[model samples]
Target: MERPRYESPVERAIREAQERGEFDNLPGAGKPLDLGDTSDPMWWVRRLAEREQLDFTGALPPAVALRKEAATFPESLTALRTEESVRAVLEDYNLRVRRDRLRPPDPRMPQLLAPTVDVENLLARWRELRAAAGPPLAEPSAPEPRRRRRWFRRR
Candidate 1:
C-alpha cells in the first residue's frame, strides 16, 4: 500500500488558501501577493513584499502612524473608555496603511490566481511553475495516433 503523505503546516495553509478565493483577481495568477501587519506595519510590509515572487527592494518609510497607534494602546487598560478610543483610532489607521500598500490591481494581472496558503507552499508553487510545466522527460510516450492503426478504425 502506498503511504499517505502527511501535510506540513505550510502545505496545509496553502491548501486552505486554495479553497478560499484569495487569488480570484490578481496579476501573474497572484504570483505576487501583499499582506501587512497592523501590529508591526513596517516589518510586516517588508515581510509581505519579500514573500512575493518578485522582489520589491527599496527604501521604506517608517510606519509612523501605525507606530503611534500601537503605542497608544496600553498593555493594561486603566480605563475602558480610553482603551476603546485608542482601539478605534488604531483600527482605522491600520486599515488605511493596508490599503495604501496593496494599491490598485493591475489590469494585466490574471482574473483567477492560485490561492496562497502558507509562505512555503506559495514559494514552492512559484518555483515549480518557474521551472517549467508538462510531463517529466523520463516518462515514455504512448504510441502516436498514426502508428496505432488498430482494427477499430474511425469512420
Candidate 2:
C-alpha cells in the first residue's frame, strides 16, 4: 500500500506545532496517560468536567441537585459550623426532594436522581467528620494593643 500523497491539515498543524515546541512541557508532559485502551462513553465529558473543576451534577435537573447534596452530605458537613447547621441543610434537602417527588411522573425528572436519604445516618456522618477534623482552633482571647498611635488622633 502506498502512503497518502498529502498529510491532513490537522497533521500538518501538529507537526508545525511540535517543531516550535508548542506541545512541550504540557500539564502531563512526562507522565503516562491515566487512561487504558478500553473506552468509556462519557470519557470526554468526565475529562472536561475534571479539567474545569466543575460539578457535573450542576447541569442536571433539580431532582439531581437534591440527591447529590444528600449523597455528599459528609463532605458538606466540614464546612458547616455546627450540628444544627448540618441538620438544617439536610432538612432543607430532604424537603426539596420530597417536594420534587410529589410531582406526577413527568419527562422533567432526572433518571438517576432518586434520593432515599436517612437523616439519622447523615447526622451520624456529620458527627464523625467533626470528630475526625478535631476541635476548632481557639480564637484570640483579646484584641492586641494598638501597634502605633493613629495619625488622626487629637493631640
Candidate 3:
C-alpha cells in the first residue's frame, strides 16, 4: 500500500477551510512580510537588530537603547544643526587666532607702538615728569601789540 500524505491536524483544517472559500478574499489578500503594518515589538526589534548588526536574542545594549531614545527624543533638528554650526565656527575662529599669533607682524611699520617691557616704570616716569613740568611760560607778548595799521594808511 502506498503511504498517504501526512498533514498535521491544524494544517489539514486550514487547507480544508481554504478549499471551502472560508478564508478567500481576505482584507489583506496577499502581501509580503516586510511590507505589512507591523505593530509587534518583535518585528521592530528584529529590524533594529538587522540594521545595527546586533543580536536580537539578547537584551538591548545600553548604547542601542540610548540611540533609540535619541532618535525619537523631542528636539528640533534645526536647533541641533544650528548648535553644531556655531560650535564649528567658534573652533575655526580659535584656530585662526592661533595661526595669526604664530605669524610675524608687519616689518614695514617699525615705528608702530609695540608692547613695552617696562610698562609700569615708563608710565610712572612719564606721569612724574608731566606733573613736575611748569606751565609753558607763554612767550611774553610784545610790550605793545603790533597794530595792523601803520603810520601811513593805505590810500
**Top TM-score model:** 2
- lDDT (Cα, 0-100) at 42 in candidate 1: 86
TM-scores of the models, in the given order? 0.19, 0.51, 0.21
Q: Kindly list the per-residue Cα lDDT of model 1 for residues 4-75, writing each as its tens digit.
A: 499788877877786797757766673655444556748765675666755442332334434443444333
The alpha-carbon deviation from the true structure for residue 67 of candidate 2, after best TM-score superposition, in angstroms, is 2.4
Kindly list the per-residue Cα lDDT of model 3 for residues 1-155, writing each as its tens digit. 34249978988888789779999887767964563347775777667767799854246433333344334322212222233443453344445444544566566633222121232443344445444564434555568766687657854
RMSD of 3: 32.2
Alpha carbon lDDT at 99, candidate 1: 59
lDDT of 2: 0.75
Candidate 2 ranges beyond 4 A from true positions: 1-56, 108-113, 139-155
Best-fitting candidate, scored by lDDT: 2
TM-score of candidate 3 on Cα atoms, chains taken together: 0.21
User: Residue pairs in steric clash, candidate 1?
Assistant: 13-117, 14-117, 27-109
